[model samples]
Target: SFSGPVTDHAASDDCGVAILGAEPDKFWHDHKGAKVNAIRTRTLISKADIIVVRFGEKYRQWNAAFDAGMASALNIPLIVMHLDEHQHALKEVDAAALATTRTPEQVVQILTYVIKGTLPV
Candidate 1:
């Protein structure tokens, strides 16, 4: 039931991807608790070459805020995809993304550019 911008990107295998918040704790409590999960999350971000910030229709403020902060603090490259066009006006959702996009394809393209060092990512 993957909808929105991730439909195509998830279907393709362009890069090694780490889908943040995709794992549901109710079904698979691998991390055990929030503290462990948070530490694991920081490790993941620190290890990643780039981070993708996908802001959907109903913005998950906590995830967005935390993930974005982690990426910034870790100096990981980031690409932000505002699935909808009006996310910039949200005001409350604050993220210092290197670049902004409206689709998964754009996010991928931006990633490519970042990897190539031709674009600010």
Candidate 2:
């Protein structure tokens, strides 16, 4: 859950977001930890209705790009969030995305609209 009105969306039976990732102890440097993360990623991608990826310098290590690829391969709708500076590096991923947005709020608005047919005011 995303806190605040994210619950409102849930209460209305409109939408809910699951932020998936490794636990703090499951860092990728550990071999067993990496396997666990791979399973988690595969499971989430297989089950997700929509997947959102936010990219940046620090995010490169998180393999957001790899997750985005899985999202595409699974035919799940994808939304990529990144700034203009990174646009060149991410154009191909964005091309595969249903939408490329700038802010977290925009992602929420897009989700709300897609799932409920109600645009943010």
Candidate 3:
């Protein structure tokens, strides 16, 4: 979950978040680790209705970019969260986001609007 009070906005019935990456025991520095990472990322992307990407320095990594690409290829609704001003490969992804946000609160609000299909302007 987002760890916020999104209920007030009627977020969604399925408001769950999954963090996909390497475990502490496995780092993404070898061929085996890379394969595992790719498979996990692909599975998560395939299952997600909407994929939220935190754009920053870490997103510059190839695996992170690959995940975004997979989400794009699958035609999932992708939201690019600009956690910081740092440039990342998310911008290179061809899929246009439904919206972009700079803060967690904004992210929740955007998710609410996206899932609900309406926003109280």
- Decide which is better by lDDT, 1 or 3: 1
TM-score of each: 0.57, 0.73, 0.60
What residue pairs are clashing in model 1? none
Pick out the ten consecutive residues of candidate 1 with the lowest summed lDDT.
Answer: 1-10
RMSD of each: 9.2, 9.5, 9.8
The local distance difference test score of each candidate is: 0.57, 0.71, 0.56
lDDT of 3 by residue, 7-121 (tens): 2222221222113332444232344444544455576678788887665555234544565667777888877666545445355653366666677678778877877887747
After superposition, which runs of candidate 3 have C-alpha atoms over 4 Å from their true positions? 1-29, 58-60, 87-90, 116-121
**Top candidate (lDDT):** 2
lDDT of 2 at 87: 91
Query: How far is 46's C-alpha from truth in model 3 (Å)?
Result: 0.6
Scored by Cα lDDT, where does model 3 land?
0.56
Give lDDT for model 1. Answer: 0.57
Ten contiguous residues with the weakest lDDT in model 2: 9-18
